[model samples]
Target: MKAAAETMPTLRAKHVTPHAFRHATAVHLISAGVDVTVIRSWLGHVSLDTTNHYARANLETKRKALEKVTAPTTPGGQPSWKRNASVLAWLDTL
Candidate 1:
């Protein structure tokens, strides 16, 4: 099995290890917007925290995601506290 894997041209990256492949898979899942819970199961991780470490999203990635979801503010726009206030009110009901 080892010989077959080694002979594959596609698997011929220099100094690649099993751990590197695992990390790559985790990162790809994150980039593809797969949930961490799904990744935990896929990677056989016993804890969600372990999956989180492996597929940790950097600050810039999160910022970009938020940017995509939120409307751009015009110059001198009023700060909108209503959104958070409504969320907090809803949480309080729960």
Candidate 2:
């Protein structure tokens, strides 16, 4: 084991720790669009807020997502669901 460690000295380089691996895994899951709740369960976190902190994205990613949202409208300036009143009323009953 000593010889192997010597061959890969950087593997035990300064400031590299197990927690870094865990943090990287969490960030990878978040980048892949995995749900926060699932990441919390995977990391055995008792509080969802802790998981949220781990998955906090940068401002640029948030801005890009917001830019992709298109408004709901039809070609003739009408609402997208003009004939969906009955469907909406049925959903409200639930």
Candidate 3:
């Protein structure tokens, strides 16, 4: 298999493995916004619990998620953190 892989430029003879391909497929599907339950079924996972590991957000994904969110503000239209700063600081000390 290694020799055959070497003849094919795209195949990394030393690095290719079934698990790597499966993992890559999972990550690709996740980035494409495929549902976790569907991904689990596609990967032949017996339970959604097993698929949760692949569904975890990496730092880049988390950053993108945070970017999409609006910061919390009080009814007065001021950012909550601005009003709470002193109280939060006191709580932190405790």
Best by lDDT: 3
lDDT of 2 by residue, 13-44 (tens): 54656788899899878877899999999999
Residue 62 in model 3: lDDT: 82
- Which one wins by TM-score: 2 or 3? 3
Q: Give the local distance difference test score of model 1.
A: 0.79
Question: Is candidate 1 or 2 superior in lDDT?
Answer: 2
Displacement of the residue 49 alpha carbon in candidate 1, Å = 0.7
Off by over 4 Å in 2: 1-14, 63-67, 70-94
Q: Write the per-residue lDDT of candidate 1 for residues 1-94, one digit (tens) a residue.
A: 3565578856555567789889988888787889999999999999899999966776766886888896868555645554567877887899
The digit string of per-residue lDDT tens for model 3 on 10-87 reads 676367778988998898788778999999999999988999889888777788788999976568787676578897
Clashes of 2: 0
Q: List the residue pairs that clash in candidate 2.
A: none
TM-score of each: 0.55, 0.54, 0.64
